[model samples]
Target: MSAAEAEAAAGSEYPAHYKVMLEKLNEQRQLDQFTDITLIVDGHQFRAHKAVLAACSQFFYKFFQDFTQEPLVEIEGVSNTAFSQLMDFTYTATLAVAGEDEAFDVWKAAEYLQMQEAIKALNKKIDEFSSLAARSTSKKRKIAETSNVITETLPTVEGEHVEIQVMGEGAIEVEESGAGGSRRRCKKCSGIVRRLRFSSSR
Candidate 1:
């Protein structure tokens, strides 16, 4: 696979928690049903949950903490586009910022809002989507440069058969283990493989 494709695939493997958060964010956006506060930016209105905005942005956090009643807020000196992306990032923890200009715009808004999480996420996405050839060291090389490590096991028992799978850096082995287990070894002893078995009594 191409370096860009590999990098994208690696980056897309976000933790399960992030997946859940993203799903909830998208669901909220789709409903657009529980917004308790409105933000007025560049003469446009945006409905959002105060808790979400306060959680993701220190600026909003302090503002909300001090004000007992603020149903509407007016932001100054931020473009509608940048604010939109910032809102999206605050809810989903993902940024769609593309070119340097777009990145800079959203970054400025994030900085103004004191949203550190959004800033870090934007930087990571920017790096991940950059041209693979533009960097001095290839991502593939970086990933491959890690010390030889093999740590994975998949065992399954179905009916009268036992199947085991061992995965390593550059190799994988699938073996069948019945009542009597099976042993597999590499010629160079590059990895450790364990046998799995199922009793015949069942």
Candidate 2:
């Protein structure tokens, strides 16, 4: 069999079953009991297991290596949302964000924290979003032509008028006149944020 198949098979073996135990540990970590360290972000305190962080990140390993008596570590540069996502991964080995913008933010925070695994996971999601954007552009053009209508498209990344939308189970639809709008869903948890582009006459 191929190397990928071999790896998958190995993952199905005994040691991989231990992930269930790790997941339970993660649930307890969330409760903030018996936590050895606290990460302070945006003036908010998040309790953490030092051993878990050190095992996952060399940066944390070096930071904790000095082993000073301090129990709280303050982190700056990363927003509270991104830091929380990082902790989510640190605990459950899962990476999730609301949308491309949030994913980028989390990836940058992962870089700052020197968490290679999280960086890789976010990179894969970034690539998926990029591909989706390309497909969307082509699909939009065809739809506009078939409808014989003039369509206007506007792209906004960050702006004052930004609005957030929650979508139902079917395909996502956004009105063109409404500028600076975003829709985010998580499929595994719900539905992940796919880009929402609207078509209308300006």
Candidate 3:
């Protein structure tokens, strides 16, 4: 792929929301060094560094708490619980949201939190959508290409000849004349007409 195309593809693979989260985390990092920050969810408090906290929003923390059903541990610096919560939130958001924008946002939040599972899941979902769109586009292109009319005339023995006209998506019409008389075929496999030709009148 060209550089532009590769960049575009990479952008598509990383959901928009995920990208935002990464930006936010980077911004937070620049503002302050990584320091423990407390997060409150469901009457419970969890501790993580400023970097991690900035990467994860309240929505993700709550989602993770609900999923774990247990009080998360507070590590000295960055907490594993925080990471787990981020991943759970991302997966949940992607599954719950109807809009691609929302899904992307949640994916980004997860990515900012440095949740591997969430990033992988988001990538997979994006890939699936991309594949579906490509297939649809391919089908449309094929339909357009096959809809044109193609006509061909072939010479035969004893002043007889055949004129073939193909129409529709894949329909073929053949008019043949010889000592045996004229014959016509429509989209049928004709072993006799081995060497078929096509041309555009327009």
lDDT of 2: 0.64
Per-candidate clash tally: 0, 8, 4
Q: Show the colliding residue pairs in model 2.
A: 185-191, 185-192, 186-190, 186-191, 186-192, 187-190, 187-191, 187-192
Ranking of candidates on lDDT, top first = 2, 1, 3
**Each candidate: what lDDT?**
0.61, 0.64, 0.42
Tell me which residue pairs clash in candidate 3: 17-104, 17-105, 17-108, 18-108
Which is the leading candidate under TM-score? 2
lDDT per residue (tens digit) for residues 1-202 in model 1: 9999988878765499877976786677646767767565654556788888888898778767865364555565577789989988777766777665677667767766778898777666555545433343455556778544332221222234323333333322223224776444322223333222222325
C-alpha RMSD values across all candidates: 28.0, 16.3, 31.8
Which regions in candidate 3 have their CA more than 4 angstroms from the true location?
1-94, 146-202
Please provide, for model 2 over 1-202, each residue's C-alpha lDDT reduced to its tens digit, 9 standing for 90 to 100: 9999999878765776678877877877977767877665654556788888887777778767855445655565567789889888887888778677788888877776678898889888877776777677768979777544343322322322212233333432221212565333322212322221212222
The candidate 2 region of ten consecutive residues with least summed lDDT is 192-201
TM-score of 2: 0.62
Error of 1 at 59 (Å): 0.6
What would the TM-scores of all predictions be? 0.53, 0.62, 0.28
